[model samples]
Target chain A: MKARVTVTLKSGVLDPQGQAIAGSLKSLGFANVGLVRQGKTFDLTLDETDPERARAAVADMCEKLLANTVIENYAIEITA
Target chain B: MKARVTVTLKSGVLDPQGQAIAGSLKSLGFANVGLVRQGKTFDLTLDETDPERARAAVADMCEKLLANTVIENYAIEITA
Candidate 1:
């Protein structure tokens, strides 16, 4: 099974990296750019054979070690 | 308008960060875990009022600044 996980900062958190990218874009003449928030993505190939178990385990993995739940949100997409 | 962009390393590229994470997971007793690849995500609120133009411009921004084309791939999701 394959899984894709995305972890993003919750709203109202200051994203210095995103802000720096936005500033660089503006300096490079990208007028259309505005606010930017940076996040993380994970692609994993699980050893699990059971689809339901794999999904649950991956979600647990995200919550436990992959994301900071207090200030971040995560979503998982699974493919078999 | 809001956009979410996901950037990932292409297959065959070495991801040391992901390997370290996976090693940590194994050490912490996550037996179901296997291969892990680390990537990046971006969330932005574009200044443009036009939705179509905003999408195009943001895609360009990813291509130009957010992702490394040689070994990375990106995807965008837009919400109004």
Candidate 2:
């Protein structure tokens, strides 16, 4: 199986990297650019004899180390 | 308009961060977890009086700053 995981800073968190990128965009004549929030993305290949168990396991993985629960939120999608 | 940009390491690029995460997952009983590749995700709000121009501009932004062409590939999606 294959899975995609996205982890993002929660609303109201300061995203310095995002801000810098947005500023750079504005300077580059991308006047249409507004706010930008940066996050992390991961794609994984897994042993998927059973998807349900894998999903739960991956979610646990996210909570444990993939994301900082106090300031970040994560989502996972599974595909074969 | 709202845009989601995903930037990923090109295939064959070494992804040390992803390898570390996968190792952590395995330690946490996510034995199903296999190879992992890590990337970046961005969510942006843009002034989209016209989407076509905005998309082109965002792509340029990606090419110029958000992603490194030598090792990364990016995809952008627009949502209003």
Candidate 3:
């Protein structure tokens, strides 16, 4: 099975990288750009075949290491 | 409009970050994990209401700065 995990910063947390990107966009003539929040994604190919088991394992991984639970939120998507 | 851009490393590229994550998982007792590729996701809120324009602008941003075109591929998603 294949699983994807997206980790994003919690709202209200300062994102300097996103701000820089937004500024660069404006400088490059893309004035319509607004708030930008950058995040991380992990695409994992697991040996497990069960979607349920795979998702559970990945979720554990996220909680234990992939994400900072206090400041970041993570979502998991499973594809068999 | 809201747009999401996911940037991933090209296949065959060495991803030490992903490798480190995988190693950590193993140390933490999650042995089912296989190949892991780490990537970036940017969630953008644009002033433009048109989905088409928002996606195009985000794509341009990806090509110019968000992604290393030589070794990364990006996918854009637009939401109104």
Tell me, by lDDT, which candidate is best. 3
Native A-B contact fraction in model 3: 0.95
Q: Of the candidates shown, which would achieve the greatest TM-score relative to the real structure?
A: 3
Which DockQ values do the candidates obtain, in the order shown? 0.80, 0.87, 0.91
* Residues A1-80, model 2: lDDT tens digits: 88898999999999999999899888888887889999999898888867787788778878888899999999999886
Model 3: CA > 4 A from native: none
lDDT of 1 by residue, A3-78 (tens): 8888999999889999999898898778777888999988888887788898898888877899999999998888
**Candidate models: Cα lDDT each:** 0.87, 0.89, 0.93
- Order of models, best lDDT first: 3, 2, 1
Number of the candidate with higher DockQ, 1 or 3: 3
Question: What lDDT score goes with residue B4 in model 2?
Answer: 92
Off by over 4 Å in 2: none
List the lowest-lDDT window of 10 residues for candidate 1 chain B: B24-33
The estimated TM-scores of all candidates read 0.91, 0.95, 0.97
Which pairs clash in the backbone of model 1? Answer: none
Compared with the true structure, what per-residue lDDT tens digits does model 1 show for residues B1-80? Answer: 88888899999999999999899878777887889999998888887778788878887887889999999988888898
Using lDDT as the measure, name the better of candidate 2 and candidate 3: 3
- Which portion of correct inter-chain contacts appears in model 1? 0.86
Candidate 3: C-alpha lDDT:
0.93
